[model samples]
Target: MAPAIMLAADAPKLSSANTGFMLICSALVMLMTPGLAFFYGGMVRVKSTLNMLMMSFISLGIVTILWVLYGFSMAFGTDHGSIVGWTSDFVGFGGIGKEDLWPGYTIPVFVFAVFQLMFAIITPALISGALADRVKFSAWSLFLILWVTVVYFPVAHWVWGTGGWAFDLGVIDFAGGTAVHINAGAAALGVILVIGKRVGFKRDPMRPHSLPLVMLGAGLLWFGWFGFNAGSWLGNDDGVGPLMFVNTQIATAAAMLAWLVYEKIRHGAFTTLGAASGAVAGLVAITPSGGAVSPLGAIAVGVIAGVLCAMAVGLKYKFGFDDSLDVVGVHMVGGIAGSLLIGFFASGKGQSDVEGLFYGGGLDQFWKQCAGVFAVLGYSLVASAVLAFLLDKTIGMRVPEDEEVSGIDQAQHAETAYDFSGTGGGLVGSAAPALAAESKKVDA
Candidate 1:
């Protein structure tokens, strides 16, 4: 115990600069939840817009409380057989000190914990997009609690926690390709399976009510993603941080272009929705491989993810699942493409020491990447499905069809997104003059 204490002391002293940087990154990451709210809200119909926003916003409230209680400890605490960490180490942050430095890092443990908490908050929120306008808000909220507890915490440990199985096996998830995006994506697929299709999934003309809102949300996500990708290094002064920053920009641009090209060839129009979705695809793809691949590799990953995800969005129509916002397609497919492509494109000269096939490495690293990807995918799928099934049987998971069609925002939240009733004295009082003038002009 004395030697252990001494080694802990001898580890790198906490740096004020790194701590401040991490705190800023945490703020940036926290903003992403609200950004996600706007993104999903705009994609939904006007009737369901508030519900969509609430779904993502609620995660910020619920997950933050859980993380403070035990989520952080479960994910990042002392290892327990590489499957999970012992929650007793930091439950309620018990025994952690203000000056306590994270193991082998220059930041305070509390700052690191908060940074991780932001990641945990946004992850489950990512799944909300798939269930829009159909699920009971109460059931969805409860699902958030159980899913994070059972699926997210354990998977986070398996990938990013010290002494985690995948970490020990040298899996190169620089950010959260497998853990966050893939985990959330697979979970999205699983829950949608249990909940079944929306009332008008194929029959109704359910288009976005507000593209400007969608663009705003997407822009915010793009800005906040800089911290998401580069801040994984825990410091900005490193060469890898700059590389990730540049790669993120390059990949996102390439993906948006690729998606636009695909849209023009396939649909004859380059829509704003396609551009935004493509950017998100690139962001998801580069998240895991940013620290491992070069700029050119990032472009390769982005273009592939763009084309594949664009094609994948149509699959729900073919296979008959109601992923309302294409979360499974853009996130899950992009994450898989990024994680697996690392086996082919990782440059040893980057942040990680391992090389990929294109960098003169062999199939060994590729296989390891595959193993990590499948492990998370399988676990998230099973765990999320079971949880959704139990909830559906017991407390009920979806709203009644009438409530869904009439509007989930009013049914679930008792409020609508827009009060058009207030528009110029109930329309007649304000529009009477314009209508009369148009009638006069027609008579003339």
Candidate 2:
């Protein structure tokens, strides 16, 4: 009886309301992965649409199993040297009990772990956008397995773990601007450089197959992101959660408008793709700084990130690295912009006493923000490149040139995203290419 009583005393207090709220937030964050699938699925050509969706969907399966195994331990376990974490009990979550609560927070430890699991599942999925239509599904799966183990787990530790260097250094990331966005963006750039460009390069337009689908996906992402950013604070313990919620909506709206304005000025037309991408840019930007800044600051971050990501997307064309879906441009650039901007916009009245450049604070917070952003970006870039390179040399990364030109869906997954048989008997799966061949035969 005394032992049980001692165990009870050791456990932190659990707030039922906060726990329920966090569970809902976890569910909302989980929705983002599927939301991402729809977003990427709608962006790719019809032939590879299923493959694109699978890239994001597969993470849900793979990362969940990993998180339960040792992923959580490696991330949030007791810190070791500030680079990694370890706790024997967290190995299989066998040591943890339902009664256990995350220290200082009112929720159960399992709730925190599962909530974070949603994040781990999506980070690697974010990189799939850059490698779309080229990579072998098996290779992509293997990359996720390795990446979350090496890149994501450690980075999560560094950015948020109790004893992490970045956490200790006063580098604030309210959600995951540096850990998730910048890390995924930099990794995407590195992989593209290693894997090289898609087959078409600059010749083909490679326009999105379905703008409506893209719009749908973007809408879902925007909806789910509120939980992603706001839930990071755990609860309204100090009212930051509500503030984050408002800032998220404000920033996203500002970004979408800013992106449209930039598009109208530069391209002479407002496109649906621009609207979706712009909203995501806003979400990414505010994810790091929303809790620290005001709604006005959020608008500033959103507008700057929107315009900058809009312009940055064109850099792929100029630099000659094919980031197929502008992952580096929007996510990496937006993440950097948001993280750094926190240094200028942070209000002492919010999350902490920290102030940005515009506030009473000077360059102190800016440099700290820089350290967190660059550290995650650099490590992820080098590590992801190495992993991609090794896989390319082994079981292989990119599909065969012939298979790629034909479409990776049939080759990788044995099924296409859609059937075109209804369209003038368009040869079932390979509609466009097959029809072209038939037209050539008729000409001959």
Candidate 3:
């Protein structure tokens, strides 16, 4: 009979175990945003810390609603020849419930929906750091909504959704090398180009306000990553989950060591920032190849990512692109390193069907991996540039010069994060110096 009616029969079944595990995974990923908030918040000048936190916090609420609506359909619907998804699956989710079927699992379609929803939420937030302290809060919120619909949905369709070109081509992104990291990394580049650099990009020291917050953020990210990488298996299979878990740990630990060593050699000090950044670099590298590579391979990926990213971060000064926070160096470089390394490590010579040049499997799989990396890099950069241009034209990008000097937190949001624990105010709490000055300016 009808195509919709017929497709219903192809739907899979839902189970409690799958549902529980996935929900937990979703929560773990959700924690990443706040972790990201702290990570980014510490990097900005103190004048804008709260604003950075708000940018990330808002994504949790805004994207969640959007995902439940057309966002899901656009990303996951029946694919239309590698470009985008058709809306035939639109509102088809209404019928999905606790007992409904998901393609890969016995979990409810809703659970799958929520799991993917967590991804959608974090991707846009990842780009926020690049635009920090310049754009209006309202404009940023609007940009995130539009960017998710335009840039994120189509990319997600191409990478993760059924019949996606990447999937069909056998590109193995265990979690989000292409879908999350590359996609967001490219978007960060686009926004940075349109917005220009933060005030005093090269001149200002702009040290992180709190190293403790950065460490906390790194810890949370490392914790949540277990879910991000392992849960990609979509279920508690006999060995895949444990394997991914071990790889995640090994890679992160190795990357941390690699980064610390690099900092010691190059900078003459093993700063806390280096360790935290190295751990993240390792995590990004492991994400793509975790499922495909063995434990030893994972360590190799981590070490390479650490050293490569450490080197890459210094390129911003030489090339002078101003990534603001090194999104390109760590995520983009690390993603490529991990994805390509798997070609050698996973080729059946060791623990997988694909072998690398080292294992004597030759260059075939390596080339395939290279092809995937270039494809993602090229597509993402071009698509992201176009989207940024469109938004820049329509809504205008970046704030006025005056606002940049005054601090976005006070100028844009009309608020400040700290009042020195109320010690800065006196005599009936004369509204705190910063707050009182702003009130007087408003009245005048």
Candidate 4:
């Protein structure tokens, strides 16, 4: 009996259940990129649909390779002064072994690495929506290479890596409120500022090419978000993962309802666009707060996010910076709302001991969340802007004016999202705007 007990004590650190769960979660998170592609693709003019989809799909290929090369090292390797991380061990996934476990978790280091890679993949893809129709595919691709290397890897280190400044300072980003949503949102704003509007700012009717595609994309995002949020807990060893799961569903539902309500009251009808964007807002808000708040708190966060994001979407017309797909309104504003609300909605009983303002924890946690949120927001905005500027000056970020005005999908990818060869004009379906405008010149 004593020999058997001693042998049992020397078991592998890996947990098969947790490992399997994380693998599933990684796959789910990976699905968000395609979901995002569809969402953005549907939101743009038909001429830009394939281009938009390609923008996101390209990242899956690009980031996966980068993550395997050095992204993981920069993000999760040993910290260097709390700003970035470094370690030769993870560079290329060479030195690591299958038996290696992520410290403080039961899953293999490989599982955690791949899981985090999914996040690294999707964050930059989120920015593509803002630059739709106007950017050169090659330029955007190069920008991703640099942006992820410079902006994402470092911020990820700060927010989630061991000994990270935000992690050490007790920021309450349950998943990626700061690192992913806000980071991408701010970056989107920066790029749009550099690239300017898509030919006809307010004069053109840039309605979505397909709402059904948008809804389908939104549904996929909402479904995959369960893994994105809940899987961040790393395992179901406790109730935090399950808690996060329930809160995710609750918050998303509330946000969707709130958006529809606001739309009906203000616009006289509940829009499908509004519902889709609202659900995403809730997903964004709950991303950083799910593990820290109660179900009721999730509802409040969702409602606030839906209303705020719904209102914020109109700011592009007000401010005159063309965000092609409202990425800034929905992601940046939604991310900020969710991250900041952690200070108010944190229940102090879920994941951490810190209490939010309503939970008797006062403004302390709120302040911490602000620091984390604004720090990431500020860094991403400035850094992303600088990257875009560099790209603009070097290879020229915007497509040629004729290509954009006629059809970006055809010009850039050499193929259209739909076939119009049977038409008298040949490809006239994709080039409807050009045929209408004829020789008219846009006021660029």
Per-residue lDDT tens digits of candidate 4, residues 133-224? Answer: 89999999999999999999999999999989999999989999999999999999998988899898799899998999999999999999
Off by over 4 Å in 2: 1-12, 423-444
What lDDT would each prediction earn against the true structure? 0.91, 0.93, 0.81, 0.93
Give the winner by TM-score: 1 or 3: 1
Better of 1 and 2 by lDDT: 2
lDDT of 1 by residue, 1-444 (tens): 999999867879879888888898889889888999998899999989989999999999999999989899889988999999876859888879999888778998899999999999999999999999899999999999999999999999999999899999988898899999999999999999999999978999989999999999999999999888888998866699889989999899989999999999999999999999999999999999989999999999899999999999999999999999999999999999999999999988788788999999998999999999999999999899999999999999999999999988778776667868774321233456787799799999
Give TM per candidate.
0.93, 0.93, 0.89, 0.93
True-vs-predicted CA distance for residue 262, candidate 2, Å: 0.5
Q: What TM-score does candidate 4 get on C-alpha atoms?
A: 0.93
- In model 3, what are the clashing residue pairs, if there are any? 14-106, 15-106, 344-356, 347-353, 347-354, 347-355, 348-352, 348-353, 348-354
Superior candidate under lDDT, 1 versus 3: 1
When summed lDDT is taken over every stretch of 10 residues in candidate 4, the lowest stretch is 421-430
Error of 1 at 203 (Å): 0.8
Which pairs of residues collide in model 4? none
lDDT score at residue 130, model 4, on the 0-100 scale: 94
